[model samples]
Target: MGKMKNGLTGGFSGKVGTLVGSSVKGQNILRNAPKKSSKNPTAGQLSHRQKFTLVSSFLRPLNGLIKRHFGSAQKLKSKVNLALAYHLKEAVNQVEDGFVVNLSKVVISKGILQTIFVDTVAIVNKELTLTWSANLVFGSVNKTDVLTVVIYQKATESMFILEQVAERGAGECKVQLPASFEDTGYGIWIFLTDVGLVECSTSVFLGEF
Candidate 1:
């Protein structure tokens, strides 16, 4: 059953046959209802579904980062959705069993802010150091910009986020790993934000270390 907003001359809301009429963002819209099928999914469809599972699960924990710094605002899609679309297309690759996110291709934050060329990723005495050189971009790079990092622990499936760990001009930032953190393999990312924290630079993957 459907209800017409302005009699039969105007748009409607509800279901009618195979079409669904609804209002979205103050606009009337009509779309076809999804049809149920008896056929089994194809191999390619299954493969894509597995990839989606892999990427979405990995990005779930970074909701705070993505929501705040992933990208500029858009009308219909949120920042997280934009990040998901980007990773699905650019960061996922097929693996032996199913799929896995290619960490090197991942981008946690995105903007016009200038980034840096990583010269080193080293950990000694439980202290992590990230060194970089200035990289050019559309916006003027500032030495006062703050560095942000996220370390993904594969064994525990957890993340350790460091906000404003150091300044970009410092060339390197040292982080003391958690006391209980064992030195297995871990994924790391680096990005920067202005002193005010109003904008961010695109993220760089430091590979698993």
Candidate 2:
């Protein structure tokens, strides 16, 4: 009975030893096993360096487009402002003359020469009259000035002398344009005196039907 008891105790001890060894081996294997990453990255997620590089790639072009649009808007605004200012100055100048020049109704009927023509539309059944004033600041002054109005077609360089008159000081001259000059666009050139002192010239268009 003593020997049987000792054998049973040894057997129990052997079983415990085997269990402890197996547990130790299992722990070591688990520690050495490959660990899984807790988080999975999507396409949007990248390294900080990569994110900065990607953003920088698109920034330059985006900035350029924004600047280009801004510049175009600024240019258009400038042109509009300039046009407004020019008309305002012209209005102020007309006030000095008591608004004698009603350019709003002026019309050029005939193509005189090279995109220039005479304002021939009859205002109040009277032939169109062109009134001009010149302030001679320098050079030789003449009391009797030879004023020549040259007309030209807007689309062509061909020009013709519409009217030439010798007048004293500032005066008004009426021109009777032939009926054939209607419908074509024209511009005017005013030559003051024979010395080629070019005065202010402007465009004239035929009135609408």
Candidate 3:
């Protein structure tokens, strides 16, 4: 019985040794596996320094674009302001000539007539007057003709004759308010037919009395 037990133990040891040898060989095969070459770096694999330069170069155009847009916006605003100022000045000048006393004063000569038109709606109860002067031009042959001044106001479909003055060479005319005519815009049309054909027109706001 002891001999049989020893025989059995030795047989088990032999089988275990064979299995260990096979495992060792398999491990060695795995260790000596073929080495795979790494693929070449793609364009996406940029260095940190290169990446920073690329980002900066891309942002340069973006920065320039923003600046250009800002400049264009400022220039457009300037042009709009200029146009607005021009129209505002013209409107102010027109209204100022009728409402303001200092700015209303003007000179008219023989060859030229200055006509200021005021809307009656703006001067209904206001005491408004028109005054102008004319000078004669010297000529060798023709006699100095008197300058004729006519003030007319148009309302709806009809034109009301406010005042007319005819004098030799130089003259002045003035109209008292409240205007007897309807509250329609007044148009001062000055005509110099005596010396030469000259006409001028000015506009004013008219107020209701």
- Among these predictions, the greatest TM-score belongs to 1
TM-score of 3: 0.24
Residue lDDT tens for model 2, 89-178: 342222442322122332212112222223343322323466544454435545454555544433433344554454525556666655
For model 3, give the 10-residue run with minimal summed lDDT.
99-108
Q: List the residue pairs that clash in candidate 1.
A: none
Clashing residue pair totals per candidate (backbone < 3 A): 0, 20, 12
- Model 2 lDDT, full chain set: 0.36
lDDT of each: 0.85, 0.36, 0.31
Q: What is the TM-score of each candidate against the true structure?
A: 0.77, 0.29, 0.24
Q: What is the RMSD, in Å, between candidate 3 and the native fold over all Cα? A: 38.6
Q: For candidate 1, lDDT tens digit of each residue in 1-209?
A: 98889887778999999999988657788899889989999998888888888888999989899999988857877898889899999998777877777888988898778777789998777788988874445457788899999888778777788899998888888899887666777888989999988889999888898
lDDT of 3 by residue, 1-209 (tens): 11222363332211232232112212311123335569876654444334344333322322322222112223334322332332333322223223211112211221223333322212335334434334434342122332233223434322333323433332443445434555455433333333443222222222212
Please give the lDDT score for candidate 3. Answer: 0.31
Q: Which stretches of candidate 2 lie over 4 Å from their true place?
A: 1-128, 134-139, 155-158, 166-168, 195-209
Error of 3 at 54 (Å): 73
